[model samples]
Target chain A: MLTPPETEPLTPEDRTLMGPGPSEVHPRVLRVMSAPLVGHLDDSFIEIMNEVQDLLRYVFQTENQWAIPVSGTGSAAMEAAFANVVEPGDTVLVPTNGYFGGRMASMAERAGGEVAYVDAPWGEPLKPAVVEDAFHQHDPDIFGFVHAETSTGALQPNVPELTDIAHEHGAYVIADSVTSLGGVEFRVDEWDIDVAYSGAQKCLSCPPGASPLTLNDRTMEKVLNRDTEVRSWYLDLSLLEGYWGDDRSYHHTAPITNIYALREALQLVAEEGLEARWERHEAMATQLKQGLEALGLELNPEDEYWLPSLNAVRIPDGIDESALLSDMQADHNLEVASGLGDLEGEIIRIGCMGYSARTSNIELVLYALEDALRNQGYEP
Target chain B: MLTPPETEPLTPEDRTLMGPGPSEVHPRVLRVMSAPLVGHLDDSFIEIMNEVQDLLRYVFQTENQWAIPVSGTGSAAMEAAFANVVEPGDTVLVPTNGYFGGRMASMAERAGGEVAYVDAPWGEPLKPAVVEDAFHQHDPDIFGFVHAETSTGALQPNVPELTDIAHEHGAYVIADSVTSLGGVEFRVDEWDIDVAYSGAQKCLSCPPGASPLTLNDRTMEKVLNRDTEVRSWYLDLSLLEGYWGDDRSYHHTAPITNIYALREALQLVAEEGLEARWERHEAMATQLKQGLEALGLELNPEDEYWLPSLNAVRIPDGIDESALLSDMQADHNLEVASGLGDLEGEIIRIGCMGYSARTSNIELVLYALEDALRNQGYEP
Candidate 1:
C-alpha cells in the first residue's frame, strides 16, 4: 500500500481573469455548479438538455435541430465537427492564417480526409477571392475557417461571401466560433455555415467541460450516411444521436454539474440579449484597446478585423514578456496571456469576454500593465 | 434574428443519488466546484494538478509516473487508454461478461485493433482458467477486463491470477475499475495492471467531467512509439504528455471546475484512507443487503463475486420494474437505477459508494424501497 501524501487544502487565489479564454464565470453560473446532480437520463435533466439546445440555437442564430453540448471542451466539439463530416478520401480545405485552422487540418487528416490549404498571413483574415481560388483549385468537400482566431485576435469579415463560395462548390463550411459566440456578432443561418462549434469557457463564461456545437440538416445527413464508422466511438455523432435526439437513450454519462453551469450561463445570455452582449464586449474591449495604445502598445489585428473578445497587443522592444506577465500577477493578482503559436513572445493577449467584460476588470488590467511597464524600466 | 426561448431558473429537485455510478458527490467536492476560475496553465492550477496526481497515485496504490485525469468523462479516459496503446493490426482481448466489455471491444476496434473475447455469462466474473485458455487460443497483444462490473454488480476476484496469465502470454492488462476505485479494494500496481481507467462520478464521488487514468512505464513506451497516429487527437496520450508531464505545456483547455471537484474528492479519499473507505462501503452495503434479504429480495451475483459498490437485486415476478423505479423517485425523490444491457428489466441497481455509503443513505434506500413496493401492491 502506498502512503498518502499530505496535501494542503485547496484555496486557489481569486484573480481577475482577463486571459485569452476561461474568462471569469458569472456568480450565478458558479453557484449553479454547486447544485446537486441529477442522473444524466433523468426527466428533469432531459428537459434541461432541451432548453440548452434551444438556447444554443438562439446564440447561433439558427433553427438547426442538432444544436447540443458535446461532452468535452472546445477541441472535442471541433473534432466532432470534422470527424463526423469529413469522410474518408474527402478533400478538406482549411485556412492557414491562424492556429485553429492548422488544428482543423490535423483533425480532418486524422478523419482520413485529404487536406488542402487556403493561405493567409498571421493576424489577417482570409480574403473571399483567395478562398474561392482554393475551392476551385482543390474542389474540396469540406471547408473550415476560424471566425474569431484566438491566437491572432482577428475576426473573419464577410462570412456570407466565404460560405457562398463553399456552397457553390458543393462543400460544407465549419466555423470555429470559439472566442466569438455570445460576445462578437455571428449568424449561422444568415452566414450559411453548415456547422459551428464554440467553447463554454470563452465568451460564454462557463467552465470548460461541456462545449456547444450546431449542425444543419445537410451536414448531419452526411454524418448519418457515412460509409465508415467514426474513428472515435465516444464522439461518433450517429451514436450520440440516440441520446440527444428524441429517443433519449443512454450513450454515456454527461458532466452533470457542467451542464448546470452551462445552462445558467446561457440563461444569462438570454436575459441580456445577444446584440446587447456583443456591444458590451466591444465597448469594454475598445476601452482596453485605448489604454494599451496610451501605453505605447500596438494591437495586432487591423481595426476592421479586430476581435473584441480577445485583444492581441504587440509587445514593445526592450520589454521581457515573461517578466511583464509575472509582475502583473504578483502585484495585482491579474491574468493576461502570452500569445500562442506563431505570435508567441511577440504579443500579449488580454480578453474582454462575458462576465469578465466589465469596466472594473478592464481598468485593473490597464493599471496593472502600466505598473508592470514602469517596473521593467520602460517609460510608456 | 432568432427569438431566445424563455428558460426558467435552474431548480433541479434534490434527490438521494444511489445508482450504478454518480453516487452522490461529496459536499466538499460540490463546494469547490463553485470556486473561482483559474487559467488551465496558471502556476496555482498546476500545483493543484500535481496534488491531484499525488492523491490519485495514493488511491490507486501505484507509484507509476503517468497518472492523470483525462479532460472528458469516463468513456474518454477509456478511449484514451485503448486508442494510444493498441496499434493497428494488434489483436486485443476483452471479456464478454458485462456492458463495459462490449464498450471495450468497440473502442479497441475503433483503435484499429482486432478484438477477441473470453466468454463469461453476465453477472459473473471471468474465470482465470478461461482467460488463460483465451490467451493461448488467440495470442492477443492486449487484454482488458472489468475489475468491478457496474451493469451486473459483479467484482472480479483473483485479479493477480488473471494478470499473471496475461503476463505469461506477453499481453498487456487493462482494468476497468470504474465502479471500484477509491471505494472498493483496487491496487493497480499490486495487480500488475498496465493500464487502468475510471470515472470520477463513481467511487470518487466527483462530478462526471474529468476522469482518472493511469499507465505504467512499459505501457506508455508502446504508446509513445505507436505505429499510427492515435485516432482521436483530443485523446492522444503523446500529446497529453506535454501537458501533464514535466513540460506543463498547453494541450486543450482542461475542464477547470471539474478538476477542482476531483481534487477535493480525492483529498477526502486521502483523509479517509483507502482501506478504511473500502471497509465502510462493504459494511454499509452489507446492511443494505441484509435489509433486502429480509424483505425477500435476492441479489443477482453470488457472494464471492458480488460488488459492494453496486447491488443488483433480482426483480420479483409480478412486479413491474419500471413502475417500482418511478414510485421510488416520485414518492421519495430517491434515485436508483434499472439494470442495463443484458440484465435490463430483470434487476434493479442500487449503488453504495463514496459519500453515498453512509448508514443514513442505506436506511433511506431501504425505507423508500419498501414504500415503493407497497405502492406497487407487491407485499413482502
Candidate 2:
C-alpha cells in the first residue's frame, strides 16, 4: 500500500563488476551521475552531447563525418549501422565465430540483405587470408566481424588487415567493438573501418542506454543515397541528424539522466589517456590470468587470441560450477557471469574493463574465487 | 587532450520542463535515481524488478503475464513489439495521422513487414470505420496505431472497438500508448490490446529509459513460436524472456537506476490510485485549456479528440514562433517546444504530463505565456 519499502536506499554495495559489461562504474562517474537533471534540449545538455561526440571520435581514433550516440542500447546502434548501410538484395559477409557476428547477419537479413559467412571456431579469430578468400568467394556488399568477442573472450587480431581486404573488394567494414572500444586499441580511421559501434556499459562505465556509433564519409554517402527511406523512423539517421546535429528538432525524448552519466564516464576516459586506459585493463587482466593459473585454472581461449577485457576461464574438472558461483556471491558479493550461447556451464567470464580494470579488484576476485572453489570441495 | 567542457563536471541547471517529456523528474524519483549501482542479477535489484513487474501489470490494467520494462526508450519498446510479432513478408496495418503512427508503420517495415495505412489527416484521430476498411482491404497480420497521438495532441477514440475489429480479422493489436498510459484511461485487457507499450516520462513522472510493454497470451505464443529468430538478437523476446522472466539469464546490461525511478513513479500512481492520477491530469488540463483560451489561444484538435496530457495551441497570426519560444525561455525560464514534422511553425506543444501536471505549474505557465507572447509582439 505504501511506496515499496525504502528497504535500503542504494547502499553502494562495493563489489568488483567482473562480467561481460556494466563494468564497475567509477566513483567519479557516479558522482557526476548524481548531478541535477537538465532539460534534454537545454543548451547545456546539447553542449554536453556535442562534447561526447568529440571524445568518442578521439577514443575511436576516427575523423568520421558521422559520429553520434544512438538513443537505444548497443543493439540499437548495431541495427542502425546495418539499416543505414545494407539495402535489400545487397550482400553482407559476416564472421560466424561469435554470437555478436551472428547478430549482425540476422539484422542485415531483416534489412533485406543476403548474407554469407566466413567461419571461425568460437575461440579463434578470423584469419585475414580466410577473409580475403571469402571476399573472392562471395563479393559481399558489406563485411562485418566482432572486434572483441564477449561471449568467448576472444580478441580478433588483424583488424586493419581484414578492413584492407574488405575495402579492396569494394565492401565497407563494420566493426562491433562493444567490449573493446576504450580499453583496447581501436583506430577506426587508421584501420579503414567504415562503421563501428559500442555500448556505454562496457569500457565507458555508463549505464546501458545510449550506444556510440561512428561512420566515415564514404559510408555516410551510401546511407544518404539510399534508394528507400530508412526503415526505422525512430532510428533513421537522417531525422536523427537534426536532433544530434546542430539543428535540434524534436524526434524523440532523449534519456536525459543516462546521457548525464555517460558524459561523466567518457570524461573519466579522456582524463586517463586512451593508451593508459588500455594499459590499465591489460595489466589487470595479466594479473588475473596469472593469479587464476596459480590457482590451477586454465583460460578457455589460447593466449594468442585471448580478450583482455573479458576472460573466460574453464571450470576446473570435478567441481560444481553453481555451488562455487553461489559461494562467491553469498560470501564475497562478487558478480562474475556464466557463459552464454554454446559455452554455458563449462566456462566463467570475468571482465576487466573500465572502472573494474584495477589491480586491487582483480586480486580480490582471484582470492575470492580460490576460496569459493576450495569451499566447494574442489582440490586446487 | 582535454575532455569536453560539458563533461568537465555536471552542474545541474534547474529549469521548468514544460514541453514533451522528459518532464521535470520528481524529487523523490531523483533521489531514488542516485541510488548506488547494483548488479542487474543482484537479489536486491531483481526483487525491485519483480515489484516493478507487478506494478507495471497493475498500471497497464492487464494480467497478460508477459509485462516488463524494455531497457531502451519508448521507441525501443515499440520496436520490441513489432520485432517479436512481425516476421518477414507479414502485412501490418497502421494509421497515418500523427508522427508517432507514421513511425509505427516505418518500424513495421523495418521488421520486414509490408505496411498498409488507414488514412487520417495530421491532427485528426483515426476513424474505426476506416481501420475496418483497411483490415478488409489489406488483410494485415498485425494492426499497429497510436492510442494517443503525441505530436498532434489527438487521442484516438474507441480502443475497445478497434481491438475487437483487429481481433475479428485475426490481427494482433499493437497499441502505442506512450503519451497516454497513466494520464488517460487505458485497459489493456478490457480493450483487448494484444500488445501495448508506453514511455515513462509521459504520465509516469520518471526519466525516459525503460518502456513498459505487455503482451497477451496469444501474442506471446506467436512470439514464442517465431519461425526465424527475431532479427535483432538484442530485441528478441526469446533472449529477453530469460532476463525479464522467471529464469534470469544474462542479457545486455540493463539501465538499473532508471528502473528504480520508474518503480518509484509507479508506486506514486498506486498510492494516488490510477483513477485519481487520471483525474488530476484531466483537471489540470482543463485549467490549462481555460487559461490558454483566456490568453486568446485556440487548442488545435477538436474537443472530443484532444489529449489531456498534451495541449496544442495554434500560434497567433503574425507572431514569430522562434522569438516567442526564445522569450519564454529567457523571460520566464519556461521550456516549451515548437511544432514538429508538418506542423512546424504553426503550433506550440505544451505538455502538462506526469509531475508537470500540477495546478501551480499550469498557472505559472499561463501567466508566463501571456507576458512572453505579448513581448514577442503577438496580438493577444
Candidate 3:
C-alpha cells in the first residue's frame, strides 16, 4: 500500500496568467465552479445545459442547433469535430500554418481520414488564393484551418473568402478559434463557417474543462451520414446529441462545475457584449505591443494579422529568454509563455485575453518585462 | 445573433447528491475550486502534478508507475483505456452484466476490436467458472469487467480469480472501477488488474473532470507497441507521458481547478485509511439497506454482491418511480437515481459514496425516500 504524504491546503500561487490560453478566470466563474452540483440528469441541470448552449451559440456567432460544450478541454473539442465529420477514406485538408493545424491533421489521420495539406509557413495565415489552389488540387471532403493561431499569434483574415472556396469545392470548413472565440471579432454565419471549436480558458476566461463546440446543419449532416462509427466513443456527437438535444437524456456525466463556470463566464460576455469585449482586448494588446516595440522588441506577425489576444514578440539580441522569464516570475507573480512548435526559442507569447485584458495588467507586464531585461544586462 | 437570457447569479438548487456518481463534494474540495489559477505548465503545477499522481496511486492501491488522471470525466478515462489497448482485429471479451459492459463493447468496437461476451444477468457478479469457460471458448486477446457495476449495484467478487483467468488465456485485464475506487475495497496490484480507470465524481466526491487511470507496465507495453495510433488524440496516453511522465512538458491544458478538487478529495481518503473508508461505506450502506427493508423494499442484488457505493433497491410494486423521484427532489432536495438499462423500472439506485457515505446522509436518504413512497400511496 502507498503512503499518502501530508498534503497542504491547495493555495496556488495566485499568479497573473498571461499565457497562450487559460487566461485568468473571472471571479464570478470561479465562484460558480464552487457551487454545489445538481445531478447531471436533474431538471435544474438540464435547464442550465440549455442556457449554456444558448450562451455558447451567442459567443460562437452561430445559430447552429448543435452549439454546446464538449466535456473536456480544447483539444477534446478539436478531436470531436474531426472524429465526427471525417469518416474513414475521407480526404481531409488541414493547414500547416500553426501548431493547432498540425494537431488537426493528427486527429484527422487518427480518425482514419487521409490528411492533405494546404501549405503555409509557420507564423503565417493561409491566404485564400493558396487555399483555393489546394482545394482545386486535393478536392478534400473536409477543410480545417486555424482562425487564430495561438502558437504564432497570427489571426487569419479573409474568412469569407476561405469559406467560399471550400463551399465551391463541396467541402465542409472547420475553424479552430481556440485563441479568439469571445475576445475577437468572428461571425460563424456571416463568415459561412460550418464548424468551429474553442477552449473555455482562452478568451472566455473560464477554467479549462468543458470546451465550446458548434456545428452548423451542413456539417452535422455529414457527421450523421458518416459511413462508419466515430472512433472515439467518449466524443461521439450522435450520442451527445441525445443529451444536448431535445431528448435531454444521459449520455455521460458532464463536468457540471465546469459548465456552471462556463455559463457564468459567457453571461459576463453577454453583459459586456462581444464587440466591446473584442475592442478591450485590442486596446490592451496595443498598449503592450507599443511598449515592446519601444523596448526594441519586434512583434512576430505582420500588423494586419496581429492577434490581439496573444502578443508574440521576437526576442532581441543579447536577451536571455529563460533568465528573463525566471526573474519576472520570481519578482512578480506573473506568467508569460515561450513560443511553441516551430517558433520555440525565438519569441515570447504575452496574452491579453478575457479578464486578463486590462490596462493595469498590460502596464504591469511591461514594467516586469523591462525590469527583468535590465537585470539581464540589456538596456530597455 | 442569439439573444442572451436574463441570467441571474448561478444558483443551482443545493442538492443532497446521492445519485450513481457526482456525490456531495467535500467542502474543502469545493473551496479549492474557487482558488486562484496557475498555468498548467507552471513549476508549481508540476509539483502539484507529482503529488496528485502519488495521491492517486495511494487510493488506487497500486505501485504502477503509470497512474495519472485522464483529463475528462469517467467515460474519457474508460475510452482512453480501450482506445489504447484494444487494437484493430483483436478479439476482446467483455461481460453483458450491466449498462457499462454494453458501453465497453461499444468502445471496444469503436477501437476496431471484435467484441465477444461473457454471460451474466444484470445485477449479478460474474462467476469464475463462466469466465473460465468463456476464455477457453473465445481465446480472447483482452478481457474487461466492471469491478463494481454501478448500474446494477453489484460488486464483483473474486477479482484475483478473474484476473487469473485472463492471464491464463494470455490476455490483459481492464477493470472499470468508477464507483468503487475510493469508498469500497479495490486492490489494483494485488488483484493483478492490468489496467483500471475511475471517475473523480463517484467515490472520490470530487467534480467530474481529471479522472483516475492506472496501467501496469504490461498494459503500457501493449499500448506503446500498438501498430496503429490511438483514435482519440486528446486521450492518447503515450502522448500524455510527456506531460505526466518524466518530461513534465505540456500535452494539453489540464483542468487545474478540477485537479485541486481531486487532490483535496484524495487527501481525505488518506486521512481515513482505505480499509476504514471501505468499512465506512459498508456500514453506511448496511444501515440504508435495513431502512429500505423496513420500508418494504428489497435490494436488487444479494448481500454478498451488494455494492457499498451504489445500492440498487427494488422499486416496490405500484410505486411510481418518476413520482417518487420528483417528490423527493421537490420536498427534500435529495438526489437518487432511477434504474438504467436492463433494470429500468424495477430498481432505484441510491448512492452512498465518498462524502455522502455518512450516517446522517444515509438516514436522511431513508427518511426522504420513505416520505416520497408514502406520498405515492405505497405502505409497508
Candidate 4:
C-alpha cells in the first residue's frame, strides 16, 4: 500500500444548502459534530442510536417497531423498501412524475416486479383518480410514489385517498418522503402509508447519510413472508434487525458519527416541535415565493400542488442557468440546483429545506439570483 | 404517528476492543470525531472527500479510477461489488472457508448469480489448488474470496497464484480484503485483483460507517458493459461514479462526518507508512500470540496460517466462556468476542488490528483474560 499524499487542510465555507437536499445543517448540530467516537455497539453509542430511532419514529409519526435509519442515504432506504416488499413477479404500480418516482419504478422493476407506471407530467402531482384507475386496471401488489417530488417541485396531495385506493386493491403503499418528512406535514399512519422512508439531509437539517424508514405491521409481515429471499443481503432488514434491534448483534458496522449528527438534528426538530417545524418551513417558503415573484420569476407549479421545501422556478428566456449557479457559488457562497432529465436547462430548483428554510437565507438567495439575472442581461 | 418513548441514556464501559472488528479506534480519531457537519457536496467537504478518496486509493494500492468509500459498512461494499458485476444467471465462484466467505456466497446468490462455493472448513484457509480445481470445473465468470478469514483466523496464502487461476479461467477476481488491506500486506494491483474492498474499522481505525472499494479497468469494463442493469440502484457503481468520480455529481448524500473520521484515520496511516503500519500490527499480534501461549492457551489454527489481525484461540477444557467474557467486561472493561457460527463457544477471538494493535493494549487484554479465566476456575 502507498501513502496518501499531503494536501491542504479542510476549510469549509458556511454555505446555506438550498438545493434539493442536504439542507443547511443547524449550527448546534455542527457544534456537537466533534463528539468522541464510540463503538457502534458500545453502550453509550447504542443509547444514542436508540434515541435516533425514537426521534425518527416521532418525526415519521409512526409507532412501528422497525422504525430505524437505513445505513446509506435516501436511495438506500428506497432500495431497502423495494427489496423487502416487491419480490420477483410482484406487480408494483409506480407513479412517474419526478425523477425519484421513476427511480422507484426502476428499482421495483429490478426487484423483478412488473412495474405499471401511473403517468403524470413532470411538474404535476399524481392524481388520486388516476391512481385509482391504474389500480383498477393493473391491480398491483405495491403502490409507490414520491410524497414530495424534489425534481419537479410537486407535492402530491390526496395521499390518504391514493393509499386507500391501493389498499382497496390489496396493495401496500411505499412513500418517498425524502424532501418532505420534517419540512412538511406527513401523517404516515393517518395516510395509511404502509412504508415511508426519509433522508436526514432534507428537512432534518443534517448532512445526508441516514435514511429514516418506518413500516407498519402489515409491511413487516410481508417482509417476513417473502417467498424468495430479498435480493440485497446487506439491506435485508432481517439481518439488520439483529444489529439495530434489541439483540444488537453485529451486522455491518454502523456509521457512529453520522448517527450522532442525525441525533442532534432530530433533537433540534423535537425542540422546535414537528408541527412548528412544518409551519416554519411553510412560512419561509411563502416568503421565498413572494420574494421570487417580486423578482418577476415564474414558479414551476401552481398553488396547493407545489412543494414548499423545494421551489422549482422556470428560468426566464436568455438567462444563463449554469452561469447563475456559478455566480451564486462564487459571489454569495450559495447553491441552487438545476433540473434533471426533461426539466434540465428549463428550471432552477431553489430549495428552502431544513435549516435553509429561514426567511433571511431565502431572501439572500432570491437577491443573489436577481442580481445574477440582471447582470446577465436577462429580464427579471 | 407516535414517537419512540424516551429512554434512559445508555452507559458504556470503556472497553478495550479485541475482536475481528471494530478494533479500538484511535483516541485522536475520536477527539477529532465531531468535525463540523458540512453538506456532502460542499466545496470544503468535497475537498475533504477527495482527500479521503486519494487516501483510499493509496491504501488499496491502486490508481483505479473508482477507488472510493461506499456509504454502508464492509458488507455493503461486498454487496456493491457483486451487485455491480454479477448480473442474473452469471456464475460466481466463492470460497467457503469462513464466515465472510459464506456471506459472499449468499450475497452473490441473492444478486441472481449461480454461486459455486469452493469448500473449506471454518478454521482453515482456502486451498489455492482446490480453488484452481473449482475454477477448472466451473469456469466461473466471477472469482470471490476473503484474503483474511476473520472467523477461522486463517490468512490465505498465495494471492498471486489464485488470481492467476481466476484470470486463466477468464474470470475477474473480487477480493474481500476487509480484514487484510491496511493491517496486513495486500497488493491489489500486483495480485491482479480486479475488484477489491475493505472495511475502515478493521485496519484503518476509523468508526465503521464506510467501506473502501476499488476496481481496475478490467472490472470497470465489466460494470460498464453489463448486459442487464445492476439490480441495486443505490449500490450501482454507474451512478456512484458520477458522485465519487471527477464529475462529482449528486448520488445520495454521503455520510459526511464518517468520511471525515476516515480521512483522518487514513492520514494517520499515511503519516506512518503502510509498511510501518503493517509491521506494527504484525508485532502486536505476535506479542498477543506469545502472551496467550504463555498463559497455556492454544491458537486454533496452525502457526503458518494464523491471521495476525484476528487470533482465534480454543477455549481450554472446563473453562466457562460466558463467565470469562462477563468477567473480562465487568473487571477489565475489555471486549473480546466469542466465535461466530460453528466456532461459537468453542473459541475466543482476540484482535490486534489498527489503532488497537499496540503492545501495551495486548498486554492489558492478556492480563485481563488471564484473570477472567482464573476466576472462571480455569487453572491458568
Question: Where does candidate 1 clash, by residue pair?
Answer: none
When only the first chain is scored, the TM-scores of the models are 0.99, 0.95, 0.99, 0.97
What fraction of the correct interface contacts does each predicted structure contain?
0.81, 0.38, 0.81, 0.61
Candidate order (TM-score): 1, 3, 4, 2
User: What lDDT does the true structure give each of the candidates?
Assistant: 0.94, 0.84, 0.91, 0.84
Q: Which is the leading candidate under lDDT? A: 1
The per-residue C-alpha lDDT of model 2 at residue A153 equals 95
* Residue B178, candidate 4: alpha-carbon lDDT: 90
Better of 2 and 4 by DockQ: 4
Ten-residue stretch with the least lDDT total in model 2 chain A: A1-10
**How well is each residue in B1-380 modelled by candidate 2, as lDDT tens digits?**
32233345667666787887767777778777766567788777788888888888888988878989987788888888988899878999888788887778778887779999899988988888998999999999999989888788888888898988999999999999999988888889888899999998888888888899999889999999988767665677888899998888666667887888888888877777888888999999999999999888999999999899999899998888888888888888788888877788899999989888998889888988888888877655
**Stretches > 4 Å off in candidate 4:** A1-3, A31-33, A43-46, A378-380, B1-4, B7-13, B31-33, B37-49
Cα deviation of B169, candidate 2, in Å: 4.0
Instruction: Please identify which of the two predictions, 1 or 4, would achieve the higher lDDT against the true structure.
Output: 1
Where does candidate 3 clash, by residue pair? none
**Tens digits of per-residue lDDT for model 4, B5-30:** 55433333456877777787776676
Q: After superposition, how far is residue B323 of candidate 2 from its true place, in Å?
A: 1.6
Error of 4 at B79 (Å): 0.8
DockQ-superior candidate, 1 or 2:
1
Model with the higher DockQ, candidate 2 or 3: 3
lDDT of 3 by residue, A198-231 (tens): 9999899999999999999988888888889999
Q: Sort every candidate by DockQ, greatest first.
A: 1, 3, 4, 2
TM-score per candidate: 0.99, 0.92, 0.99, 0.95
Ten residues in a row with the worst lDDT in model 3 chain B? B1-10
